[model samples]
Target: MASAVRDRTAGTTILDALETYLAAPKPRDPGDPSREEFLDLVHATPALRDHFMRMQRNWETTLAHAIAEESGLPDDDLQARALARFALDIGALAQESPDPAHALRTLFARLRNGWTDFPHPGP
Candidate 1:
């Protein structure tokens, strides 16, 4: 069906954007070199990958629900926006973070707390 094709296309587009955004450099304040240095530290860490993946999944779900409620979009459309927002949210988070480590740490902490509070569903 056309709807299924549209949904697939949208999902692919969003995932591509997220891939590009994640590889981009962190934002910096004009007068602050230390901020860049801190971001470098955060970027250099190998452990942040797991944290990033978890946060991405959570953000995707959050965005889908929020957009659906706000815009009254169809489920498929909302899903597409959720995927697109994955990149946008990461960019926003990078800009807002005081330091790269802090941004990553905040995500990890949130994910940890969420898992702790809710039991995982599985057989």
Candidate 2:
């Protein structure tokens, strides 16, 4: 993946490729090359896989921090639990929604509303 990112011949980074892939219309059937091609790219590139894993970790941490701050929860354990619950809800939403984009938007809206409704912990 590092080489793919640095490939001067391609004139594009792995991030650029990812953006292009995501921006394109999603495949409707099993024969679609987009999904397979993207997976192949990821599997072939170790750096891309590592980068994605790191991004996932960072995303979870960021979400946990945001939830903790908004809810005024000082305990690390509480933040971790909240993050786990949030992730589960997101997974469920993604599985239930036909459109991935809509699912993501709904997840954000749900999280924001939930946090807003939560009673902040006293200092």
Best candidate, TM-score: 2
In model 1, the Cα lDDT at residue 97 comes to 74
Error of 1 at 86 (Å): 6.0
Query: Residue by residue across 7-39, what tens digits does model 2's lDDT show?
Result: 324565333432333334654876666644765
Q: How many residue pairs clash in each candidate?
A: 0, 1
Which tens-of-lDDT digit does each residue in 22-115 have in candidate 1?
Answer: 5446686788767446556656876665676577666665556544543467655856564446444655575567674466445445433545
Candidate 2 deviant stretches above 4 angstroms = 1-40, 78-123
Model 1: per-residue Cα lDDT at residue 28:
68
Which pairs in model 2 have colliding backbones?
1-45
**Residue 2, candidate 1: alpha-carbon lDDT:** 18
Query: Which ranges in model 1 have alpha carbons more than 4 Å from their true place?
Result: 1-38, 74-90, 93-123
Q: Go through the candidates in order and give each one's C-alpha lDDT.
A: 0.51, 0.53
Task: Give RMSD (Å) of candidate 2 vs. truth.
Answer: 13.1
TM-score of 2: 0.39
